[model samples]
Target: MSIKSFAAKIFAGYIRKKIDNWASRPVEVQEKVFRKLIKKGRSTKFGKDHDFLNISNHKEFAEKVPVRDYEELRFYVDKMVAGEPDILWPGKPLYYAKTSGTTSGAKYIPLTRDSMPTHIEAARNAILCYIAETGNSRFVDGKMIFLQGSPEMEEKNGVKLGRLSGIVAHYVPAYLQRNRLPSWETNCIEDWESKVDAIVEETRNENMTVISGIPSWVQMYFENLKARTGKPVGELFPNFNLFIYGGVNYEPYRAKFENLIGRKVDSIELFPASEGFFAFQDKQNEKGMLLQLNSGIFYEFIKADEFFEEKPKRLTIGEVETGVNYVLIISSTAGLWAYNIGDTVQFTSLSPYRVIVSGRIKHFISAFGEHVIAKEVEEAMQEATSSTGARITEFSVAPQITPEGDELPYHEWFIEFEKEPENMDVFRDVLDKTLQEQNSYYFDLIEGKILQKLKISTMPANGFQDYMRSIGKLGGQNKLPRLSNDRKIAEQLEKIKKQ
Candidate 1:
């Protein structure tokens, strides 16, 4: 190993020990984090407005500070954007992560000086944890590529504004700076297609090892690389072994990715957002990511099923249980208080608090009182593909309430296939049966003649990509929702579906 790799191994071992120390006492660490956040929050305008002075514990905190989404929190956020100090966090924010909001047009999530380091540390420790566990530090000596947004930033009221990934690009550690690709100019390209082409030209022949990005965008890069060089990505970059990703589940895309790379590679899943870096896969054999209990963020969980109910009970980390889906709420050093990020997660391990992102709270179908989530659909698809030896490129699920004929209302699955299943009927049956088995309400609806078996609508090649492009969200942290309650995305898919 090179000197740098040797040093990394030693550092990784130290970091792993530190992680274990905190992870061992998850509840205690979280309590300490909660205290610190509450203490700091008392100084902010929001804190005072919510009567933070008398709040002594999680219960009081929840009672005083109602969970608010971005739109609900915009009053304070707007003040922060207008250069007001102490509106949310102390002083002005260091940066504003600009993201396209669902209801609100544009959201500027603050990145305070105190909270910024946690993001950097969590990302670094994710790799360090991998190195320590697998004893694979040599990849650190090879080139690493993060398919992400431009590093360029715009200033609004003296605060730097850009995508979260772009802001993070500025903080790439000095040690890995030498090994990171593509060139700054290539990353700065506004168009994703042009950027991917430039990236391919810049790093096609280089010794790349660690590649990280959303799976869909990386799939596009892999396809472009194959098109140019007539070789699988693995053959082109022999050293590449680790694939790190977040934003969406990778299971549905796993078969397609394996086919593109021509081999199976280990991957790390991260749960990161503009609000906070919540978790990361710590072990190769583990089912879920290790929740960051001590990351200067206080976490609360409300059972997803009861999330819509009035005055739903909120549970702290110590109160959460395994296998139960809960909507994740966070109050962080970044000044977000009792903020709902809209993500639902299920705990796989309660001892160290490991969780998998289950789905979005809003992204589910309940058109017929048969609520179905993204995780269920993705799991069903995974099982069907595994059984049929089919490879899916992309897919989305929506409730089809009104059929053209006498057919009963059913779930419509829009699928883009990398390799179509030999038996379409069998594939559809497996999907429907699997979904019914997982969701009891859906099972009742189907059995009671209220809904028919789910139907599959195959899309033409690049159909999903075309839909994303048409909506002006083709790349850079944008993700196609896996499940939708309405037909907005489904209708768009229909327009581009193969005849």
Candidate 2:
């Protein structure tokens, strides 16, 4: 056996043993870790202000610190960015993960020396756990290309500034670095198209076995590779067996990915965010992701209906029930205190505490009280694609509720297609029918003549790309909002189409 294979076997065993105790009593593990987090940050300004010293449990912690959105927490984050020590967490942050938050601009989130592990360790162990479960160590023996952001971190106020993916890429472990494709120079190319071209050239002949990135970028890479070399991706890299994806839902793009790959490959879903590395698909056969409980982040959940209220109810792991959409709140060692990250998640299993992302609190369409979310839209699209022989590259939806009073309001969709549906009218009907079945409010709106059926506009080629680039949010972890309550994004799409 190869030395690398031997090392992977040992590492997999160690990881499995390390995490076995965690699944047995998840609530206990989180409770114990929450106390540790409170104690660790008790000396910071945020800790003292929130009475962390007097708080020893979840109830006490929630009572003292109010749940805050990014706008409210931006005060402390601003101080940290201005080079203030102990403003939120103890000492200055090593770097800030630049991301698009609630505001129109970028939000700089802190990544402290102590809290970096919450990102790094969780990602590493996610892979290790997968290997332990599947006994697939051959992935470690070949090159794996992470189609991530540029690793060229810029300095702001004497601290590094980059996207979360770029920050993680910077710290790619030395062992994996030996098997990783695309040099740092190629990764640093700011123009995404140019970088993708460089990546295609670099990884074309490599012994690639594992690929990781957002599903859209990975698809683009595969498409380009096929263009450059007249062969299917599976034929080029016969050993490529794993595809890791996160950031956005992969359901709508799955068909396109499979077509490009020319076969079914194992894929893992991750729920990592700028706030923390939250959850990952640990067991290949499991339907839901295993939440990361002992990762220095204390989690709280509030039902989506209650989350927007003046006094929201916060629930711990012990209180969450399966199949209900709950807004996620976190108090992390990375200096966030009872921060609401605006993500909506649903628990699938309470015994081992497995969950999956439902939607974003702000990204849903409920202008007319339909209360439609990302999960609803994505699943509906998946069904539509399956039934209509179509493939979606990207799509977004908005409520057209203020249409001519004589006519009923309807849902408007702007779609960029990899392969257009054989019959567009049928595809739209399938989506509308599925959504009506899934949501009572939407059905009521349709039945009572309050709204008409869905309206889908097949966008010009690369419509989404042009829109993103025009707004300077073109690449590197930037994802298009899939659903919105207003016509702002739809109007923007029209402008992009005209241009």
Clash count of each predicted structure: 0, 0
Alpha carbon deviation, residue 63, candidate 1 (Å): 1.6
By summed lDDT, the worst window of 10 consecutive residues in model 2 runs over 98-107
Global lDDT scores for all candidate models: 0.93, 0.87
lDDT string, candidate 2, 1-499, tens digits: 6788778878988987877788777888888888888888899888888888999888888789999887888788888898889988889998899887556578898888878877998888888888888878888889999888888788988999988888988788898899997898998898998988999999998999999988877877888999999888998999999998888888899898888889999988899988899999888988778898888888999999777778878999889999899999998888888888888999988878889898999999898899999999999999999988799889999988777758778999899988998888999999999999889999999999888999998888888878888887777477888899899989999888787
Worst 10 residues of 1 by lDDT: 490-499
lDDT of 2 at 177: 91
Candidate 2 TM-score to native = 0.97
Off by over 4 Å in 2: 101-104
lDDT of 1 at 100: 94
Clashes counted in candidate 1 amount to: 0
TM-score of every model versus the real structure: 0.99, 0.97
